[model samples]
Target: MISENKIYFYPIWLRIWHGINAMGILILIVTGINMQFSNPKFGLVNFELAVNLHNISGILVTINYLLFFFGNILTSNKRYYRLKRKGLFKRLQLQVDYYTSGMFKNQQPPFPLSEKRKFNPMQKVSYLTVMYLFVPGLVITGLALLFPETIIENVYSVSGIFLTAILHASLGFLVSIFLIIHLYVASIGKNPLNNFKSIINGYHDIHGH
Candidate 1:
């Protein structure tokens, strides 16, 4: 029989970070949509307010992410981020196989949890990429928009304001796509609310390495 013991998993800080991050991303998405479709002659109805709110939310998200980074360090959760010697493509392929075939055949997950490495194979790739690539990219672009003067001073060779705006919008769209996929995948736990409950109460009763 499966164990039913309540084991501590996600900590309170992580729960707070997750909730805040989700909300911040949602706000950004709503504002982004409004800004994208604004009618210029409508007297700055959606464009002005949406862009303002989005920038505020971006600032909050940046602060929240820094706190999350510090929390991970304090809790020694950085071990989960250490990549294995195995190649990224190989590891990704293995995870894909497990999800496609093994999961349906009662086979165990290829890469399971431990005190050190709690993330599964796919999570290792996804979360790491989000942090190192997506989040940083978005933050940099947002900051450039927030302080065009300073940025232009630093990088005099920049293409132009319009080019920068294009880049920022592209990254924001990518983040929105990731958020949707992440939310859908979060629902695929032992139960519909299993993952969410784990984040809330810090326990998920499952076997792992």
Candidate 2:
């Protein structure tokens, strides 16, 4: 199958959600850092302000995530996240090879973007794990911290809030790192900025597949 160079990849609703989620994540990371390393002279945000902003951003992100969750279920976009079990390991290896060696040596991607597949093997797995597992875990921990009464005071002896905070911070850190990798990967392709623009324009410039 063949088509034009441009493909409408991100729909308007998806784009809006993506934008809001991105902003919320950025806010969370910044405020999280400020809160973690509280210092009036050097902190990027006031401790009180940071706590308020982090809570608010966390709530917004949670709501946005729910929307994204339902949107995928209600729309055809879920197809892109679906996994094909056959040759999954081999496909992941090839995609990893392409990223580590092939791309720099002018080799085509093992899994090029297409009307049917928005993600490569690695992307699918990473996205699935992050969105489904890490994200929900983060949201649950965040909500627990936001409302401590809902959780028991201790977990098998350790303070519940302490454990919850540690888990929340750990998940937040991993998600932040994922955002960094996501940006770097998005910056690849013929024109680096084209990938970034595609989200805004809703049309990705596909290299012939």
Given candidate 1, what's the lDDT at residue 86?
Answer: 61
Question: For candidate 2, lDDT tens digit of each residue in 1-209?
Answer: 23478888877988999999999999999999788778768988778889999999999999999998998899888899999899999999998888889988999888889888888888899999999998999999999999999877988999989999999999999999999999988888668788889899888888832
> For model 2, what is the error of residue 91's alpha carbon versus the real structure, in angstroms, after optimal superposition?
0.4
Candidate 2: what lDDT? 0.89
Q: Pick the candidate with the highest TM-score.
A: 2
Q: Tens digits of per-residue lDDT for model 1 on 1-209? A: 12465457777777888889989989988888778767777533477788889999999999888886776677677878877766878878877887788777877877766545578778877888888788888888888888886555333666566667778888888888888888777776677678777778778656532
lDDT of each: 0.77, 0.89
